[model samples]
Target: MEPPGNATAADKADAVETRHRAVLRKFIVRARRVEEHSLAADKERLLAWARGTVTLKFEPQSGNSTMTWDLPEEESLDSLAARCRPFLLQGDPVYHGKVTNALGFFLRLAPDELRNYLREIRESWRPLDPGDRETIGYESRTGSISQALGDLVTDKELAYAWLYGDLVHADDNGEERLHGHDIDARFQAGALLITNVAVKAISTLNLARAAQSQNYLTLEDSVFTERVVARPKREVRVEKFATAPVGTPPAEIEAALDGVVPRPDSSKD
Candidate 1:
């Protein structure tokens, strides 16, 4: 990656500057993707599900009698984890590590400049119109971007613990770290913290866009395209099952099955 031996000092300087700009551009791209993923995630809905605000109802398919069961805490956590997996999982494009690393690069490139830019952007959003008093309250219900980033940095260990131990893979070390903790509380904290991280990512789009305007960076307009897509609607229904005596034949159970679709038979192929 070194410049040619005959290259002049000006050439070397230009090359290095180009490389640094490339880093900023890369960070901008990743930050944009994080925002896109966050939008699709629907932060409020995920938070509600993670916080157990939504009642989870399910019917057993194999039980001898028809009944509805409330989803257990473990299952609820699993559902929440699935929604969170794309944003926090290690290999995911929008993983917290990737987002943080990009922001770290921006910091490394120009520490004071980046801090100043963030402050300026946040303050710019501070002023509100006199007629907007109803919506603009004493403070934001969700913390500011700077606050979110600060919390994410301070609580990094907990973030990873939640990711590795509960939300994604069950690493032994992660589980050990989670030992002696209230499972639900830790999970709730982790989910909210993750949401904050997403907020940080989304907020930084504002910063990056502002930076581009100031000539601190550059980005394409297409990077900010609307990415959220509507999901197709589907119908949900409960299946009925009846109690049977012991030693019931498989044929009888198969005959009694209702609303059960048989899987494709692959053996013929």
Candidate 2:
């Protein structure tokens, strides 16, 4: 039969099904074996398997220290610290809680690094005692990172991290109480970019009149005109006529003026 056609279509399908079933059986068996092996293994082995695989070295420092990670060359330690500072100052309770918890996790993973950084921060910040409270009490009351930032940002306030600033006399015995710090602060208002257009309009007019009859009106017959006319036979008057050479409605003139003049926003002006 053509030597079984090398492998018939039906045979190929059967082979594929058999392989798939075999894989499923192997997976089932492996899972069971794993469960049994886990039960038989000692607590230490199981614990070791469950623990995180990555390892980071921690170098302790004296008094205060700086922990440098194997970071990219472009990144600076001060920049990293500054980035973390704002997160610690978030105002939302939820964000504050989450950041504090994450910091706790970092401490657990690298206690030496975290503690050293914290010590450095505390050393830089001044502590306050009840006896010295009067000196900077105003700052102590309202100088929070949140309040200071609010004054600058004009937006949502920031939360305070628990370990941000140091407390004085925290470990003192009876009568000596702990006092929080008053952080020295400065703020600058952002400049507003504004654009404005100014405009103005002006109009002018001239008029002339004429006298037609000397009997009705007189100009040259008057004593004031005697200097120019010299002598006049009789008191003469000449009729005067007047006509407007150019005229425009006051409202129309006002409307035209309005188009060229810039009106200020009364509220802001």
Candidate 3:
């Protein structure tokens, strides 16, 4: 959970250049294998990409649908929190309250923020006069809520840290060396992502509410109007084999693929 050096200022005072160096070091280590090339240029190139930011964009779509995309460096915390408040309020009293507080705790928001937010929504609530038939079943509510949670935790990649509950670092060494404040710092960064997830969840909840406001539809019957879609992409940058190509095998093929340096027979068995 170490903080990103410079692109983001929310979590730490760590210099961006310094953080970039560390990230590059790790990136270089991973990118080193399966290729024989100088990394100075690649280091600079990838560092530039790492130094970039992540942003969230929202657009209105047809038929009550809203679309959201996370751009390179522009997420709106205000928009995120606005989305969370309404969605959390839709939940049943006990569990929903706890989830709200959990978000408050992790995101480091004011203690009463969740409570106050829910209260405000309630105060603002007015039952539709077209009403008596406007009701959604528990099964419909749960199903829709579950679907919304899935969207936040997966596909969108917004609540990754929260969903997985761990530090996500890619290393050839397969070791997580972060300790102490580094963990909290990264958690802070993740909290920012969580804010976006909360908003998306709220959007789904609104869709369900829309269906509920109508005569015959239950939550499950609600048309899904809001969606967060990530463009599918696949890139094959390198290809390396543990076994040498065809019949001309290199002696170091196994070692290179295993990433193991040869061990001398220093200790006799």
Candidate 4:
């Protein structure tokens, strides 16, 4: 979009630059929020699952379950990815026609050094080599495992497959492909990719801010936050129950464990 008709060429260029800066700043702020609330909030849990410190267990007599620390009930990671879909979404904004991605913003407006750094961060999301049989492995639903010798899948592919297939919308082929897999592992793996994206965004913003301070970036200071005050950090608290609360009725306990323990209706079958 052109500036006012009376504006000079320099004024028009400045207007465009200012608008780009504003969008870049917005992406940075959103990235920080996602990092803190979505990723950081579940960092330990994600890592635990990724490293197999915590795992899902299925009881032959009962059913499958994740540990309390795993936070099986929390959907923030998946939901956050869904909410930030536009960051990875391709194409330009409908009306603005400006790029709406962190990497794109950096590539278009940032210095060469900063742009390269962001690019590297993005590339890190891709697997080192899809055909590396030694590192990559595959397992089917039947518990058979084999080396990923051919047609190996990359981290990006697996992550997006899970994201589009299971969480966001049910893509028919994606669903079939992911069928009969360890659901928690798939979810966590996809979340790791999402984490990379969040990290890339936050890193880009921080680097841009640092570049501006160092005069590597010559943009006006209006695009960055002036005073970022840190709020007091809250402590995480967990309450535990060894068994049903004292004085709880048998029927209430049964109701509480309705799904975990089979109900009369289900057992009848």
Candidate 5:
């Protein structure tokens, strides 16, 4: 039965979906659970959005702790850039939000990565520090990741496990070289977040819709929470299955075999 009010079940669904998409459209991050083949397209989309040729308008939703926005078709890139120019290249929360979403979408990064990503951003602010900047490069298609940071993009085991956790991939035995979400990209993604050209341009365009009134996007470490509350379901499942009975064929029973094979002498015997 439908609930009484202006809002019905279908209305709620539409509201939730609209909220979901409104949330997605505000960030430059790739969509969660995107198929590997579609990543190329996502990459292109991000590039185009960054380039500022895309048409969009800023429309903030009703909230403050988290600001939600909808993108509408309108205006030029110059107008978009004007809005973000103040926040550009600065350690802004809006900038951080984009990076967080990117890592969450691409790496499905561990809860700890939140700290690491923040540190990376703060570290990028110092122009004199040639350490990580030299070590990590732009257009670096291939290299090993710093355990201090992340692993190699070529690590299929890691990629497969992450993708599987997200339910995006199942088969682990892919002999072919798959396109990996590289550390450089992941690092560069959030890390560029001392807000360089790519980050400034892309993130501005992405969040242009909501940049006027913004706060941090909520991201929780659900995995860590699960680990803390997780119970021993496996043992209980095993016990239940073990007690399940299979019908015995009396004709085929080895009733005499126990005696013939020399069963242990019973105390009652």
Candidate 6:
């Protein structure tokens, strides 16, 4: 995992762990055979849309692995952590304790601070008592605590880096690059939650309006005939896990999706 040009060697090393371990979830969004003009415009549009501090996990896919970004938002850590308490304490007490402990360790807060936070969490945990017999509702909020904690941590680190000018950068070389500011943030833990948030957010966006607003540039050279045929294909390949420590890399997750489902080879007649 080499860092992009313009990045320091230390930055590259930091990025390997930060990007690989911290990503919680990944989404693959693709548009095929769009007009070349539209494609170029779309790429720019996507980059602009992605800019800014939002609490989400995003990374553009390349050949082998993806470089994940932890978007920031204006939310306090305690508030966000409170939102996730119910989800953390839902089913089993033991599991809830484990989650709370993990979060405490990650936040580096004292026992007293953890207790105060848990007190606030307990105070706010009354909604589940209302007996709302809805499966979707439960699932929807099941990961709230984890999600909120993840968001707060990401935002906090990003905000600090932004203020101190300690953020890492990589050149945009027509490919994806990873940032390596917070190597110990455990982004992978929050990946799924942030991804869900991103999906819901994108669902409400008007892409057609975006397309219309951007001026598409034409190649003015290449042309395609009307009879061109495109084939739909899907394939799955499994490989042995020989990467970093288990659970340290994205591939260690039991539910993480890996590899490309290549499009079928096409033959011209």
Candidate with the greatest lDDT versus the true structure:
4
Error of 5 at 203 (Å): 7.3
Candidate 6 residue-wise lDDT, 8-126, digit = tens: 98998677534322221110011112221121234443333234223444455643544444432323222222233223334533222333333333234334644465444433332
Computed on alpha carbons, the lDDT of every model, listed in order, comes to 0.49, 0.25, 0.32, 0.53, 0.33, 0.30
Candidate 4 per-residue C-alpha lDDT over 132-176 given as tens digits, one digit per residue, 9 for 90 to 100: 222212332323456333333444456666677678888752444
lDDT of 5 at 102: 39
- Per-residue lDDT tens digits for candidate 5, residues 172-257, read 53222323544222322222221233343333333322322232333332311223222537454332111213684443245443
**Clashes per candidate, residues 3 or more apart or on different chains:** 0, 13, 10, 0, 0, 8
Candidate 3, residues 1-269, lDDT tens digits: the string is 46755545755534533443333222222222201122112434323322223344444553354433222221332233222332233342312333333332322333364335544433322211112133111101112433432111111122232223443333221113221223233333334443333323342233224323542122223123322322367577666666556874464666787788666567977
Instruction: Candidate 4: list runs displaced more than 4 Å.
Output: 2-12, 41-74, 92-119, 122-152, 215-269
**Model 3: ten consecutive residues of lowest lDDT:** 134-143
Tell me the spans in candidate 5 whose CA falls farther than 4 Å from its real position. 1-43, 48-75, 89-111, 123-269
RMSD of 5: 22.5
Q: Deviation in angstroms for 65 in model 6?
A: 8.8
**Top candidate by TM-score:** 4
Candidate 4 is scored at a TM of 0.51
Score candidate 4 by lDDT. 0.53
TM-score versus the correct structure, for each prediction: 0.43, 0.17, 0.20, 0.51, 0.19, 0.16
Better of 1 and 6 by lDDT: 1
Instruction: Pick out the ten consecutive residues of candidate 6 with the lowest summed lDDT.
Output: 23-32
User: Model 3: what TM-score?
Assistant: 0.20
lDDT of 2 by residue, 197-260 (tens): 0000000000000110312112233222223212437676855433333684455456555553
Error of 1 at 190 (Å): 1.6
User: For each candidate, C-alpha RMSD in Å?
Assistant: 19.0, 40.9, 23.5, 17.7, 22.5, 26.6
